[model samples]
Target: MLGPAERAWCVVVPHQPRGARMARHRLSTELVGTIRPGLLADVVAVLAELVGNSVRHAAPLPGEVIRVAWRHRLDGDHDIVQVRVTDGGGGAVPRLRPTDLDSLDGRGLHIVAALATRWGSDRDGLGQSVWAEFRAPAARLPGPDGDDPAPNDLLATR
Candidate 1:
């Protein structure tokens, strides 16, 4: 677990399908010892969807690159993991689109919505950044009674 201060990890890769895979690898490696298995899986999936969207929708301009970053911080009792993927500008704004059962695509945002606690996207001067936040399961600690402390109690400590 990180201290009270925020800690971040990031990578920049060429805008391509392979770049998303590379970003996933880097994210997994960086978070190996820090994040729990289940939460790690969710985080990786979110990264993939965001990066894949950048590759498929926001084609990079000359000299542009896709950037993926994750930051960890303690918010009260919860450990908050925030991820952002930025790509070159000029793509359509990301939104949830209804898909038919016969459709083979268009589920990326759906998956992200299901997994992330909160998510949104914004346009910047250079490009758009899609961001998501997930609250990691709280760490178990012995309470005064020698049993696990309730979640509310943990927050009070903060």
Candidate 2:
């Protein structure tokens, strides 16, 4: 469950080629001292892929900006991280493609799907948002009754 300590971080950048790099750097810096190393890598990779896709496909309108937001929280006993990238809508919706091994491109969503426990996108009047969620190893902590909760019990709380 998310507590008062769980706060999301967000940034908006110009919808340009360099925006993806900017978003990635911001995400890396925000996560540097907070998350575990292995999980951090996966989260960063997903951020890059999603941001790159937005830059490549969903080009923003003349004065529009891309929005990136991320948050880390404890859902029951699990540590969950969620990220969202939104851009102006003008391109085809993103989907997983069946690319051959020799293809030089079209693998970003596949990587995202593999790394993220769950991922999807939403579209509104402004644009579309691609979001992904990653779960890290749960930290064992004593429950209200002064005993650690079982894994199944923890899941049930969620």
Candidate 3:
């Protein structure tokens, strides 16, 4: 497993359907080897949903683009990943509302909520941002004596 490491990245893409694709690819590329495969996949999926929502429902920022950002850090042996997608403000805020069972649409926020440990939205002067945080594998594991792993373990599972 990888050692304790931290990184962040941001990219601005045109506010179009293709923007989500680009953001997903960038997220996967930046985080590929730094995290476990399953964790990376979940992060990428969350990024996709956030970007897709911005492109489909919100307007472009001042530059007619959407900003996708992510941060990866070790929080006391817990690996955490948070992704944010920013777009021009919309009349409605992003939130989890019950969807029709037979409906073919409006489940993006639901999927994000299911996979992310926490999620919410914030508004700025020019735009709004929707973000989610996920927890990666921790360093703690049963020791020879069935005790918690040492602090020096560093959660190195890479």
Candidate 4:
């Protein structure tokens, strides 16, 4: 179990067709509950780009699956939300190119870096997971306790 200081939440999207569909289906539903409206918008946008990148670049073969996961955390005083999109693709680390300004296709990563607090990638036996983190609003509160009398109660806001 994670300490209260750790604000991150981890979600796993398996590497299968059903997993991919499930991932998409859960995006709005899950995030709507976990994230604030404004911050949620940013997170979802970044997620779309990263997930699309995985679909286009990752996936081991013609019909392989991609895995995606995300977690929210607090690093120091900053509240952070991190997302990881994993796929079987083993391409080079994505980069932002000057020419990307003129092209419509390659700006995804650039937009991610601009909007996210930090972003990177990792490759292990499980394949690759590209990650991005964004700072939530300072006024935002931590999530509710499971046993709260009022289900709408948020820890930090209290």
| Highest TM-score scorer | 3
Cα deviation at 87, candidate 3, in Å, is 0.4
Clashing residue pairs in candidate 1, if any? none
Q: TM-scores across all candidates?
A: 0.81, 0.80, 0.83, 0.70
Q: Per-residue lDDT for 1-158 in model 1, tens only?
A: 65544578877888988888998899888766455678888988999899889888886735767988899765666767899998875457889999999999999999999999999999777578999999976555566678976543543444
For model 4, the superposed segments whose C-alpha errors exceed 4 Å read 5-25, 61-63, 74-78, 138-158
The best-first sequence of candidates by TM-score reads: 3, 1, 2, 4
Name the best candidate (by lDDT): 3
Query: Where does model 3 exceed 4 Å of error?
Result: 1-4, 138-158
The candidate with the higher lDDT, 1 or 2, is 1
- Which model, 3 or 4, shows the larger lDDT? 3
After the best TM-score superposition of candidate 2, give how far the Cα of residue 111 lies from its true spot, in angstroms.
Answer: 0.6
By lDDT: ranked, best first: 3, 1, 2, 4
- lDDT value for model 2: 0.79
- Lowest lDDT sum, 10 consecutive residues, model 4, at 149-158
Each prediction's whole-model lDDT (CA)? 0.80, 0.79, 0.81, 0.64
lDDT of 2 by residue, 1-158 (tens): 54543647888877876887888788888766455677888998998888888877887744767888999775655668899998886467778999999999999999999999999999977678999999877545456687976533543343
lDDT of 4 by residue, 38-68 (tens): 7777777788778777766666432455555
lDDT of 3 by residue, 76-103 (tens): 6577889999998677988887789898
